[model samples]
Structures are given as C-alpha cells and as structure tokens.
Target: MEELFNLTYKDEVEILKDEDDFEALGDEKYLNHPDMEARLYWAFCRPNGSCEAQIKDIDPLVSIMAFNHSKLNALKRFTLLHKEVIENPNLRVKIKNRTRMLFRSLVDDDFKELNKVLDIVPVFLEVAVDQLKNGRKWNDIFADEIEATIFMQKAEKFIDDSFKEALFFKLKDLRELDQEELKEHLEEIIEKKEKIHTLILKHYKNEVDKWIEKSNLHLLQKMTIKKLAEKLI
Candidate 1:
C-alpha cells in the first residue's frame, strides 16, 4: 500500500511490464508488448477504434497488475484514471471503460480491501445521477456498447459476492451470541439481511433502460467502491 502511495505516473509503464514472468500464470499469456504508451493513447483516443481493440490493447497489463501485483495497485490505477477524467472531462467515457477493466479484474477479496481503503460507490452514484439528470445519454455512459455490457456483468458479480460475504459474516456473528442474545437479535439480523438483499436487487440490471432512468443511480457503483475515489471528480 505504501508503494502504491509513492507510485508516480512516470513509473506506470515499468510497473505494467511483465517482469518476473507473472503473466504466464493463466492459460492465456500476456506478452509485454513494447510501445505501451502509444497503445494506451490509441486505446483511449481513437474515435473509431473497435471495442475489442481498445480493451485488448491494455487489458493484459491491467489484468496482471490487478491480479498478480496487489489490489492497492489496481486502486492506484483507478485513481489515476479518475484524475485523468478530472483533467479532461471529455475523456470520461473512455477512461471509465479502462477503470472498469481494473474493477472486473479484481476478486471478492480485492473488493473488500477497496471498500476498506475508500468507499467510492456513493460518489459514483452521485455523479451518475447528476449526469443523467443533466441529459447525458445512456449510450454515453461507457465508451461503447460492448464495454457497457461487460461492465454491467462485472457489476452483477460484485453485487452477488457482496451479498454472500455479508450473509456469511452476519451468520458468523449470530453464532457467537448467547441463546438469549440470539433471540433478541433475530429480528435485527433478518432486517439487516433483508436490507442487503434489497440493496443488491436495486442494482440488478432488470433492464438497461429502466436502470438508467432510476433516480437513485445506485447502479454499478457498488462494484468498485474503493477504486472510484477520483472517478467522478
């Protein structure tokens, strides 16, 4: 985590390198391609680039960094993207896609760590709702249709994992209570669980059109609550 705090933009390329053969862990290999900066620029700037082209160009490095390095490193990248968007609000759509890549690469444990470090869901929701209310089109929410779909899928997984983790911890706590305490807390426990379920269901993407119109904007914000610190700034 300390290392993440000290990471400057100048070192981003080095950190993204496939040093130590970390990319060979999975079935697919992520070769450390050269001219990474140029690829990144094109990925984010090309007006007519294919969604596959944009994601494929950088996902290998983002994946290795998120899964192999540390969750904090992912947060760092996400925050940096947020800063980029802040500096150039026009890049919001493009940068959002890249940040969601980091979000998708993270596991349940990484999400937990992110929540601990920074609760970013509310901030994202606020921004989303504000933008929609200001007339930002649904199609403009992400870089493209494919990215929107992928991001929503990852959001659903995050919601499911969060609900299960909450339930497990709640049950564990209940087990430690005395019989009398358990009896007294039964209603409270049920209420808490129901609340979690309700929150999860609220973002369950019943329909994209319906979700976008929902005033609360509690959409995919829950997926990377930790990494969204600068996302909407």
Candidate 2:
C-alpha cells in the first residue's frame, strides 16, 4: 500500500539515526543543539552524501521535504530536490508519484507556502503536465473542483501560457467522455475543468487590459490586444 511507503515528520526524524533519541532529552536542549541537526540536514541534502547513497529510494524523503515543517525549510529542501530531480534521471522516475502528490497537497492547501518559493512552481507544473500526458487519473492531479479552482486563482500566474493551453486542451478532452463513463465522479472532473477554463480566460483578458492600459494605445491597442489573445490562448 502507498501508506506503507509514506513518510511522516516522525518517520523522517527517525531516519536521521539518533535524532529522536537526542530530541527526547529536552525540547530546549534539542532545539539549541544545532550541530547534530545541521550535520544530518547536510547528510540528507547533499547529492553525494552518505544519506543519499544509503537511501535507495527517495520518494518518501522528497515528499516529506516538499511539505516540510516550515516554509523556509521546505524552500531549502525544494531547491535541493529540484536540483536532484533535474540532474538525476533515476530520481525523476522515483519521484513522479510523490511530486504529483505534492501538487495535490499544494492545491488542497490553497498554496499557502508557494509564495515563499515561486520559482519552484514551474517544475511542479511541468511534473503535472507530464503526469497528464502519461494518462494519470484526474483525481490524482487535483483534490476536487473547489481546491482546483483555488489553484487556478492563486497559482495560475506561475503557469506558462503553453502549459495553460495544454491543460485546457486536455481538460476539454476529458469533458468529451461519454455518458457511461460520466457516472463515476466524472461530473466533478467536468466542473473542475470548466472552472479552470473560465479562470484562464479571465486571466488572459485581465493581462491584456493591463497591457493596454500601460501602453496607452487607442483603437489600434484593441487590435494589438486581439493579436496578443490569439497568440496567448
């Protein structure tokens, strides 16, 4: 079961060898003792460190690090995970499910910590597109219509125009499913896709309006905006 492989904060701490034991001494003392924690953090973070070599599978570790205890810590871990995922083909394969799960969590959480590391959003978006292209289930990609619409509102700016087009096209394809398949929570999928489509269009229109206002063009500006919409959508 996936739960068997899932790691919690406690599970991650235990993997630090003596972290749990050290923490049991006292919360204050454990918090003050940075040397040991620093060493362990580095051990786990470093690409060539012993921890990396010892852990044959990094899926759970990556998942835990993605949504770490604090925004700052998660930002740091995300930077390292991004590097590893980009540099190591093996890591990319191992991290696929966990990465999708991270996206789902971010959506469900309304992207609370995403502003801390906006640059990393693109990689998550890329992973999402990869999953969709590989025929991953809709539920695996998003929590539900409400959570997904929140994502469209908050995280849509980070999504590239091409990615939006691909997502829209795919969602449209999903909508075309027959009535037989519609019985299985397909309506939720339909609602999610429709909301996302509308949000994207609204974003595009708002962007064009802002551009037009900034450029201070008259009738010709409207023509330029039309061209821009043609290119963007």
Candidate 3:
C-alpha cells in the first residue's frame, strides 16, 4: 500500500498532478469526509492565500509542492517546509523561487528531509487515538514473537510454517496456549529482552484543537499541525 501522505495502507498512491487529477478525485460526496476535503482544500484552494492572478502566471511546480506539503498534517508540513527541506534540496529551492515570499515568511531554515513533518504526526496521533501513554511499544510486542520464533525454530520436526506465521503475528495469544513448559520458556525470554513503553506522554494536547496551543513546540511545528487540524476540526 502506498498512500501519499499519512495513510500507510492504500494500495496505490493517488497523486493530484493537476486540475484534471483533482476533479477526478473529488466530488460532492468526497467533501463529506473531512480529511479528504481538507487535503483537497489545503492542496488546491490554499485558503491562506489571496492571490487573484492568472493561472498562467503561477508556476505549476509550486502547486505540486504545495499539494505535497498539504499531505503532511498541516503543522508538520510547516515544520519541514521551514526546518527541513524536501527530499531534494532542488525542490525546496524551486518552490522558494516560485512562491518567493509566502514560504520565506513561514519558515526560513535551510534544513529539509522529506517526511520529517509526517513522522511526528503519527506519534501524536497514536497517543491521542489509542491513549497509549503507559503501555508496551508495539515493537516490543513483535519482539516477543521473535523470541518465540527463535525458540520454536530449533524444533523443525514439529513447528510448521503456519505455526510460525501465527507466532509472528500473535494471531492467537500465546499466554493462554496449553503448552505450559514452552510458554514458560518463552516468557523468560520476554522478561529478559522486552523494553517498556514510556510512562510520560509528551503530547499533552487533549483535543486535536489544542495541539497548536502548546508554547514549547517550535512555531513552524505548531503552524504545520494547526493547518491540518483546522480542516478537520
């Protein structure tokens, strides 16, 4: 799956290359979904801008970059737009060349890494959605599976490929399994190797609306998150 922005599981990324591409993706019904419409609005409408110039005068490259920027949660987009450059330094230079003042005003930093903004959104999103402030990290859960897999792998005669798959996915809970001796052995491995998730939740923003209100965050970071939040909230 290759979703362009935040979504990781889409089968093919739908790139809005131009007016025609946007028209194809959008409809009256499409507007019903807040996120889709927000993406479209930020990407095309650019509610922040007040330009009335002719389409021919606007650089096409700027539109593409802006839309790509829109894919990031608004606040995060702002972060990368200023704090980090695009995957390419050239694209940042190109956008700066075209837009000139708007971006220059928002973020003046020269650093850029594609998806620098995107990476932070999910960290907050999971904390908010799942309320995972005090819990095991998912990677550690997967590590338990790894421990079990290594132990089981030694017994090639008994453990089949399907069993290995289930073990990896934790499709069935190992804790309740009937094999007590193997379970104890696996539990011991987990005890020694497992890492704990953090107790402190860095994201104190209870409402998505409040994410931008925190003063400790960089201004560009707040700007990026705030813009995306505006569309949905």
Candidate 2 ranges beyond 4 A from true positions: 1-76, 111-118, 129-233
* Tens digits of lDDT, candidate 1, 1-233: 24733654335324544445422321121223354543443333222322332343344433222322233344554443323343454544444543444433332231343332234332343232222223222221112222222333334534345433432322223224443453344333334443333332222222223323443435464233212211211
Please, what is the whole-model Cα lDDT of each candidate in the order they appear?
0.34, 0.42, 0.33
Candidate 2 per-residue lDDT, tens place, 1-233, comes to: 24524664345445544455443333332222334443334334432232222222244333333323223333444554535554566656655564565544443333344433345645465554443334334443323334445445545555666646444433323233332342233334334444544654454445445554555346774574445444433
Candidate whose lDDT is highest:
2
Off by over 4 Å in 3: 1-172, 175-185, 188-194, 197-233
lDDT, candidate 1, residue 95?
45
Q: What is the overall TM-score of model 3 with all chains considered together?
A: 0.19
Of candidates 3 and 2, the better by lDDT:
2
* lDDT-best of 1 and 2: 2
Once superposed on the true structure, which residue ranges of model 1 sit more than 4 Å away at CA? 1-72, 86-88, 105-107, 116-233
Candidate 3 — worst ten consecutive residues by lDDT sum? 196-205
Clash tally for model 2: 0
**How does candidate 2 fare on TM-score?**
0.30
**Model 2 weakest lDDT span, ten residues long:** 48-57
Q: What tens digits encode model 3's per-residue C-alpha lDDT throughout 129-213?
A: 1112222223323333233333333333444454333333432233333334323433443354333111101111123334235
Report the C-alpha displacement of residue 121, candidate 2, in angstroms. 6.3
> Taking the candidates one at a time, how many backbone clashes does each contain?
1, 0, 7
